[model samples]
Target: MLTSYTIAVIGGTGPQGKGLGYRFARHGHTVVLGSRSAEKAVPVAEEVAARLTGVDGAGAVSGAANAEAVAQADVVLLAVPWDGHDELVGSLDLAGKTVISCVNPLAFDKRGAHGAVVDAGEGSAAEHAQQLAPEATVVGAFHNVSAVHLWGEYDYLDEDVLVVGDVVEAKQVAQDLAVAVTSRRGIDAGKLRLARVLEPLTAVLISVNRKYKVNSGLRISGLEGIER
Candidate 1:
């Protein structure tokens, strides 16, 4: 039998990861919050259940270490940071899975701005991840969403998520997950190669938010009518 469309948030104990985990659970999909340490993920999973207690059709969420969680999960969200990206990618068996990458490669010091030192030559973090996990259909998403904003009580009444990937079906799965979290619509920003643009844009947004001391997000006004 085919597995249920359960979602797994690898490294999902953190802000962005937990946010997606909570969203997925609230939408009634079983969510496994995967972490480097399963013990650490347990508290985070409990927090997701507490935060989303009142949502309709909500289901239970659990925790596990990364490898174990991904093995049984249908949709996998890669939420580990740039520093651990390579190591995390190397640990997975992603054949035929839909892997959504929510990472941005940034190198910044306390005093200044440093750009990403990319490994893919193409400079897109998502591309690098996809190259490492060739059998998985990798898609770029949630790059621009601030972790703080994501974990907080933002209604996200309507927002825009830039979804990028080479495979159409993979991108659609990523978009479906995005919509479950918000009334926001996800716009397919074309092949994962375009993630070169999206990833750096995240750094720019970080710089802006750091200077402004408020949540900063990119939202496009005209996308709601297109209906993808």
Candidate 2:
């Protein structure tokens, strides 16, 4: 049975966030497209609603300010860039909510994109988020999925999401949401600390995508018939 959840994407006006909002809404979850500018968020939600017209719960999306969206959601996904991550997350009160972050700490240069060495003392961006929202159950996920593929019109999304968190149920909530989006598999990659491993791997995927001119993602093989 699929659990119906109300999800709020904090950076939902952006490509990654909009794509996720669309997917969740298509699957009957109430999706809130949150942004610093509520004005921008509205149109993004409207567009998602238009795309999801024939879906089972097409009208399940809306837009709002970041704080408002967080207030209404059963779960919150952070898709904001790393530059503004700390400030944006620090301003919110996410106590008692399932907060999922996919922010990869990376930087681009003339050469190519590379993972930024995290100096926050916490290891990764997800850990930084965990520190920002102490009362919230923070789970790291969606780090390696491509924004382009996420918003593409493919019949199904074929990829794997690595979900990591200290809390058992919180990780389950993150995994459930991952599966809710599409046929993609969400694997429990262990404790919150493992975010250190998953975050930088995104940079490697980016490098590969650029080199091959493909929107590639992650897939851990050798595990056959793994139960979700």
Candidate 3:
């Protein structure tokens, strides 16, 4: 019983956002790719829609201004950069919405990427998001999913999506979306606080990608028969 949702992806012009929007549309969810302005987002949405024109089970894809997109959807995904996170989230009215935060706070240097220190909430981008939008049920997920693999031609991605949140129902929505993307397990990793660990963990995966010259992802074992 897959439920269709109207998903608004903030920063949807970015690679990660566009990739996730494609998957959501592929699964029959109406996807609105949000940018600072409709002008920027519309072309990208048209491009994505063009790519999915004949794909089976694909749903409608559109574009709008960030706030307008959020106003039109029940579910909103924050995929913006860490630098503009607070201001963008604070400006939006996310009351009574299921908000998914996949914005990893990371900084790159000559030494490669590392987790940037988050000053608000519990020191993770998700927690900070929750802090800014107290009325929104925020869930942390899709942090480690590769944009490259997501945009690839594969029918299903091969990896586990770890979901963390304080609210059970909101977390379940994220987990369901994860399964929608992977068609596999979406593990309930733990509470929202665990986002502290998960956000930083992406840096490690990025390093692995650089070292191996491949897009790497996570897969958990030992839960074959257990319900997620």
Each model's TM-score, in the order given? 0.91, 0.95, 0.97
RMSD value for candidate 2: 1.5
Inter-residue clash pairs, candidate 1: none
| Global lDDT of each candidate | 0.80, 0.86, 0.92
Candidate 1, TM-score vs. the true structure?
0.91
- Considering lDDT, which of the candidate structures 2 and 3 is the better prediction for this target? 3
Question: In candidate 3, residue 131 scores what lDDT?
Answer: 90
Best-fitting candidate, measured by TM-score? Answer: 3
Clashes of each: 0, 0, 0
lDDT of 3 by residue, 1-228 (tens): 767899999989999999999999988899999999999999999989999988898989999999999999989999999997899999999999999999999989999999887765358989888999999999999999999998899888988999999999998888888866899647888899899989989999999999999999998989888988
Sort order, TM-score high to low: 3, 2, 1
Per-candidate Cα RMSD to the true structure, in Å, reads 2.7, 1.5, 1.2
Candidate 3 ranges beyond 4 A from true positions: none
TM-score of 3: 0.97
Which order, best to worst by lDDT? 3, 2, 1
